[model samples]
Target: MEVILARPRGFCAGVNRAINVVNKALEVYQPPVYVLHEIVHNTHVIRELEEKGAVFVEQLEDIPKGSIAIFSAHGVSQAVKERANELGLRTINATCPLVSKVHRRVSLLNKINYDVVVIGHKGHPEVEGTCGHASGSVHVVSSPDEVQCLQVNTPSRVGYVTQTTLSIDDTAEMLKALRRRFPEISAPSRTDICFATSNRQTAVRELSKAVDLILVVGSKNSSNSNRLREVAQKNNIPAHLIDHAGEIERGWLDKARRIGITAGASAPEHLVTELVAWLRENYKVRTVREMDGVDETICFQLPPI
Candidate 1:
């Protein structure tokens, strides 16, 4: 089997900064640094950090008073921040700058009297947080069907935003449905979906051309990772989204002479390395090369010292 690696895979700038902030906070401050959510959604990354005394909490009240608290890369609503402040928590927000842009857009829309329609999975932490900002101004729509059946208090004044880690095709379809229903609805001039999500999907489309099977390394709950797998399958490539090497059955890949490997932005590089080593030892893996694509250099700065 030959392996084709996808460029711009694993640990996007946002995830890097969030994880680093937690570790660095642990190093700089006292033990048991608290995080609002999974720093990035990878179980391995979270477990490793948890071992270092980073506490993950869903509620601000759960965190000890006066503790050092860091928000996840997925970003949080102003309500959470305000509550944290009320509790005297030292805030170290590691929200990805791209996501921060979405929050600002929602904030601006609310001020302008535009009701926001967020296209994302319900109960997703990112969706929940973004919704918090536009509590009275926002409504959630998941699938294109939801858009068709969706009710709006003011369709003309409707604006749409999305979770950064959504399937491009699926979201486009949802947007089309929205536009059909609300002809006057406005969309973001700049995409809130972030560059990394687009680049990874583009790379996977390329991978599907030469490879018969594609492997996406990411957690089950990871939206972006799931989108990568879906994008490959949509292109008629047999694909599987596995969390690690243990999930690789080898049976599914037996017929594949060329296999493509890509990880979600929140996934780690080491997981890819571990899978490659396993393939090299067991399968007759002979060739390996990275499929070229867009160059990514986006970075989010650490919170003020």
Candidate 2:
């Protein structure tokens, strides 16, 4: 069996910054530093942080009064930040700068009296946080089909933003549909999907061409990771999204000569190495190569101390 790895697969700049935020908070703050959500979506990453004295909470009220609270990389609604302030929590925003950019775009649309149309899955934390930036009309649509039934005050006064972790192709189709329906609709000067999401998907697409099966290492709830699996499957290649090497099933590898391995933006590179080690131990892996892809040097600065 031959193994192909996707370059720029794990830990994008935002994820690195978010994780570093938590780690730095743990080092600077008192024990039990609280995080609004999973710092990023990987269980292993969260587990490691937990071992280092970080506590993950879903609600601001769950955190102790006057405790240090860090926002997740998915970002949070402005309301969450206000509530944390109300509770006297010392907050460090670990929101990915890219996600924050979307929030700012939504805020700008609201300021201009334009009804915002968010292209993302409803109820997703990022989508919810982004929509929260708009105090006026905001619509969330996951697909191009949803655009047909979307209601707005005026099609000409509408603007759109996207979840940072969305599939590039899916978002493009939705954008095309939106533009077709509302010729006057406006969008950010650049696409809202982050560099990491786009680069990883591109690498996976390249991997699919040379491999018989693809294994995506990421948690189920991780949006970018799930998108990687979807990108492969959409190409009619067999793919599986797993949280770790333990989830890999030998049966899935039957009749597979070449396998491609990639991880979601939030996943750790160590997981990929672990998966490769497992493959080498179990299968007659003859060659391991990394497909050439984008070289990501982007890094986000940590929140002020």
Q: What is the C-alpha lDDT of each candidate?
A: 0.88, 0.92
Q: Could you say which candidate leads in lDDT?
A: 2
Taking the tens digit of each residue's C-alpha lDDT, what string does model 2 give over 1-305? 99999987999999999999988888887579999988899999999999999999988999999899999999998888899999999999999999999999999899889999999999888998888788889999998889999989987899999999999999889989999999999879998999899999999999999999999999999999999999999998999999999998889999999999999998999999999999999989999999898899888888895
* Global local distance difference test of model 1: 0.88
Task: State the lDDT of candidate 1 residue by residue for 159-273, as single tens digits.
Answer: 9899998988888888889989999988899777878998999899988998999999999989899999999999999999999989988689878899999999999999999
Colliding pairs, model 2? none
TM-score of 1: 0.96
What candidate 1 gets wrong by more than 4 Å, as runs, is none
- Model 2 CA deviation exceeding 4 Å by range: none
Residue 275 shift from truth in candidate 1, angstroms? 0.7
